[model samples]
Target: MDHDHTLFHRDDVVALRHDLALSLRAAAHHGLGEGICNHFSVMLGGNSGLFLINPHGLHWAEVGPDDIVLVDERGERVAGAHGVERTAMFIHAAVHKLAGKTCVLHTHMPHATALTVTPSGKLNTKLSQNAMRFHRRVAFDADYNGLAFDETEGERIAAALQGADVAFLANHGVVVCGESLAAAYDDLYYLERACQLEVLARSMGGGLAEVSDQVAEATAAQFARDRDQSRLFFEALRRELPLP
Candidate 1:
């Protein structure tokens, strides 16, 4: 488990570090954090399989740019702190290595977690336009094997992603991956909105009103073709929570 020095080169290093810190702060602001748990990581570049992660046990608010650590795809901490979070190594490292996802963000946000504890633990896709966007995009990992502290568990969770960008972990929280930090952050925001709307709508005791399959498919397609707006979305959010 030796660290690779080549992975720590200066290319895009500052930007990645800033974005990682900004997202953690945003997570804290949006109430996506649960104490000092969960993790946000971004792959440095293609093929290198090197990435940066927030410090283990550092509350989201306290995770500044200098606090992020570097690790290789094999879950080895090549730079920064002596140890990274076990679950981060298991989950983020596995997905970035196997699935080639650039950004792997997991959060135990309230609404997202609520969906996992339900009987089906599925995202109610028919709830809203936000919900419809996840109609065919949401992946579910019904096997809640407690905390992921090893490579095997990480592999299982990555397999569950099944090429999908978002996953709802039953009895747990959620994982969302994207080709860029911006895409991942945008999806994370919309997903929380989708889950929150569904939970609130269902809790009213008035049963549920759902959109049709055709509309859902069409709407999801619209979201899929929304790649151009992802930057704008993340920029807007970052603006709302401007960092010094």
Candidate 2:
């Protein structure tokens, strides 16, 4: 929470914008994006109460430094473009109000969202090692009240996600947030991979042999103690982008 409270260097904004675009393109290439519908954001300028996201209507691959939209905590557009997506505003604005997390990434990635819509969409820790990484760490929002078009909806989502790094909205999709942009992207990537593995395993009709709660907990502990794992994963992915 409150990552910083000082003036953000101009170069900070420049790097934030560039890295954000790279992440968007990476998401697109990996088929983790919908038809310009998902949202990703990073806070801009320390203590400036400002954040940046791609403007509505731009495909993830098309997002660039100039196309990034700046918005206040209230979700009003302050820079880059005229309008912000209503649901994007609703969810992101509410989340950024909290501390600790800086970058928030929400997606309709098929693998993960497919699980969300199923009766057992919640990630089961016993499902796989990746699943174990989220053991007892996921917030499941069992209710889906249509689209998040207002602040009230945003507040609800934020409340459901409290104290957790990831939120799996039943019948909706997933939300991943992290203290840094790389961590956020890395988590999103792993989340989708975990879901894909689970779904495929289930498709084999083996009835999902999940690990015991004890083992799952141990795996989660191991993941939490993992130093720089997410950073390394994200950096490797970033190198494949047009530029860092």
Candidate 3:
């Protein structure tokens, strides 16, 4: 496939590349990445049918702006030096298309994946303040049909989201989607923290303390109103990381 040099060089596209690379690096820094398996992607801009994703075989820590691959809806690599991972194409493409998510982040970070393998099957949003941020904003896919080797599995997973921003994939991993890279990464980072807290609480062997539905809903509303915080958090990551 021919490369779109002009599109890649556009200022907004360049900035998005930087943001995506920074997000991958930050996820690795926070130990949220699992080798080269998990993937992150962002739509180019406003349903352009093109998106940016990290190439296969590159560790998240080493992915730079130039390493982000441009992939079209058909799973073809429009640009970048390396090929897209099969699952990355299937899962991300379906979510981008079917779910209409602008940014999709899929990971198997330990604490969150831990919850997936449990009988509870999802996060307890009313259990902790951090968890409250996701109140009524999570979906669960109880069916784990193995690796997404094709589009059908991907569509199934996307449909499983059921209009929620976060999805807990039963016995597999977690998917976090948002309107932008900053927003998605913010949710991914905090989701792990919330899961970590819950897992730790469970290990302590006492009855867990959960807040009332009214309190959880109120807290989530407050978080929803403070959308700028997600942008600020991503900016902080960019500043802290050794990106150039």
> Across residues 170-236, which tens digit of lDDT does each residue of candidate 3 receive?
9999999999999999999999999999999999999999999999999999999999999999989
Cα error, candidate 1, residue 56 (Å): 0.9
**Total clashes for model 2:** 3
TM-score of each: 0.93, 0.90, 0.97
Estimate, for each residue in 86-205, the C-alpha lDDT of model 1 and write its tens digit: 888898888888877889999998998899999979788877899887887788888888789778877888899888888888888999998888888888888999889988988888
Question: Scored by Cα lDDT, where does model 2 land?
Answer: 0.81
Q: What is the C-alpha lDDT of each candidate?
A: 0.84, 0.81, 0.93
lDDT of candidate 3 vs native?
Answer: 0.93
Evaluated with lDDT, which candidate comes out highest? 3
What tens digits encode model 2's per-residue C-alpha lDDT throughout 129-183? 9888888878888888989876777677788887898989888899998888888
